[model samples]
Target chain A: MNVIDHVRDMAAAGLHSNVRIISSLLLTMSTNNPELFSPSQKYQLLVYHADAIFHDKEYRNAACKYNMALQQKKVLSKTTKVRPSSTGGTTSALQAQNLPSEIEVKYKIAECYTILKLDKDAISVLEGIPSRQRTPKINMMLANLYRKAGQERSAVTSYKEVLRQCPLALDAIIGLLSLSVKGAEVASMTMDVIQSIPNLDWLSVWIKAHAFTHGGDNQRCGTWKHFGI
Target chain B: MNVIDHVRDMAAAGLHSNVRIISSLLLTMSTNNPELFSPSQKYQLLVYHADAIFHDKEYRNAACKYNMALQQKKVLSKTTKVRPSSTGGTTSALQAQNLPSEIEVKYKIAECYTILKLDKDAISVLEGIPSRQRTPKINMMLANLYRKAGQERSAVTSYKEVLRQCPLALDAIIGLLSLSVKGAEVASMTMDVIQSIPNLDWLSVWIKAHAFTHGGDNQRCGTWKHFGI
Candidate 1:
């Protein structure tokens, strides 16, 4: 196996320190012999190195490496397009190799920014993804960052999007309520998402209790006790 | 693509009701035309059908399908072993196809059991996995189930196991504290996990705040405000 593969195996085995050392060493060696590795290999190496650094709590360095990996991936994508016939095969093979996808790498970069308390940067990275490509996880992250940044309107939109995809996401429900969304509106949205689920009437009651508790409507909250809370 | 693959794609595209209908139809067809699918294909179909059912909030039926998928996987494994040389190739290919692993299927079954409020069955499904293969997610689920079952000692052990793997798991920390674990012991354990992270001395303070609050020691909790809470 190649050095990158070895480092990946070490990573899979949870030998983070070993992976960090080997990946860093190989990355340095590649600088003197650039032709020694393909663009995809270089990208994978950088990600592995960054992942190990991230595991070791070096968020700043990890973010830098992840950014570099993203650049390398862009380069790889460009080169793959030049060889049209092999593009599909190469893409599938890389996926089989379990390298981080572009979206996953971006998410990691955002996570690093979040840990460093750079909420704006994190939000930008997440928002840069095309809306159609945004998964529930991405939307949840954006919703949280928006809430923290006090962009209540955007937070409300993102939280609602998350609920549409995952009705059982209790945090999103609470997030919407805390953002001063009308409880009835939030409950109506939840009902639309969960309508197909049979015998889930208690969920609406539970959500009402949360809404009342968050809204500080103690009179309404107390009435929920009739449902046995 | 085949019906199972199409169902998976539909599920991924958020066409859950379509997946439920088509997968159910395909599963019934497979009963008559058993020769039409390979064992792995059969397993994948069952998982997809169960996933759709699970998504529709049919926990009991989903649990049954997931259990059947597990049994199919066992048959697949035994057949795989009979062809020794092809074992490695088949296993890797199966992984590339993104079929759920045995551990993941077990976790899903446990989730269904948990939702059905069959705490004992949930605990048993979780515990049946070999200890080494028990991931933090599994341990966390098991820990919650154990706590609910009032098996305090097992709950404590599972919570600690989760903390060891994931120090930033705030819920596990809270679980430990709520179980009446000594505040000092829990804090010391957290310190060991976060020691490598720079400028994270505040994490210890944060954990201490949680511990004191859970312990109902208001005086110590109040003292934390000097660190700005």
Candidate 2:
């Protein structure tokens, strides 16, 4: 089997350190002999190495590798466009290959930054993603980092975005409440999303309970017991 | 769409709280009318409810639901055997439906127990998994729980099992060395597993560095700079 297959097999078998070591060796070889692999193959190798390093908790090195992989991907795309016929593969085939998107790479980079306690860097990386393409996971993460960084307004906006996409995200609701957003307003935001569900009145009650608890309204919090928590 | 479809779509959309609430409602309806679903369907519902609850951070309730799911799966397998023709589906079809295995359910139960600070319960649940079927994840969790519960010998055995399966499991190696196992001995254990690698003499150096750090032998640890970590 080729070295890539060996690396993949080791990864599948959960020999993560071995995968990291072997992938690093392959990456070094590719660096020394650039003609050894096509641009797409080089990008894949860098991502594999980065993933293994990430799994091994070498976040700083993993982030560097992920950045390198991103650059290689850009090169692959540019080369594909400039000389489409020379690449020896159809563009459709290239698209079908399970390559990670730019957003995913950035998300991973942000994850490494988060783990390294560079919240500002993580936030910046996440913010680079266009708002139209931001998933709830991305919004929630940004909300959390914003809250941690004392960017209350941005945090509130991000949390609201999360609630818009996923009304049942309890953490996002709590995040908004903790930022002094009104409990009633936050609970109402979920109303449209949950209208289809029968007998979901208890959800609003649950949200109110969280809000009351966060706002220190002990009397209203006590009333939730009547609904049988 | 049916309630099940709704619940699934909500789950896919990351509306975990909605999934939990709706699944609970359906579960209540199914309880009132036992004929509403087949044994396997009931098992699937219980697992869905348990997963949603798990995601919602309600560990105690999630554990209960998972246990109930396991019981339902038992009923499913039993019913399948007693009247295979009456179930309206082939046994293989039932098997192909992505139901969680016994080991997987036990792992989830153990995870909840761990999160709830019930380490003893977690250890017992993990221990119930037959020895031969224990994966590295199970063994690693069991090892950590054993260490926390002051069962050093059992922890050592489990960690060793982990290292045996995946020699590059750095945490397990560190786990062994932390229990006073010699660095050289731990390093030697990985030799047979990693013999295929062309240049891996640095692995022993890496292990020795960890050992020196753990043993507080700073003098020897300083020499690792020669290898360029």
The local distance difference test score of each candidate is 0.78, 0.78
- CAPRI rating of model 1: incorrect
In the range A64-149, model 2's lDDT, one tens digit per residue, is: 99999989988988977887676367664665375556777788899899989999999999998999988777887899899999
Give the interface RMSD of each candidate: 12.6, 5.6
Please list all clashing residue pairs in model 2, or write none if there are none: none
Task: Tell me the tens digit of each residue's lDDT in model 2 across B1-229.
Answer: 3345545555666555546665775687678779876777677778778888887679999999999998888898888778767636766575536555668778889989998999999999998899999988788889889988889999999999988876667678888888878898898888775565644556677788878888888888875794564
Top candidate by DockQ: 2
Provide the TM-score for each candidate, comma-separated: 0.51, 0.62
Which parts of model 1 are misplaced by more than 4 Å? A86-98, A192-195, A224-229, B1-229
Model 2, position B215: C-alpha lDDT score: 86
DockQ of candidate 1 compared with the true complex: 0.03
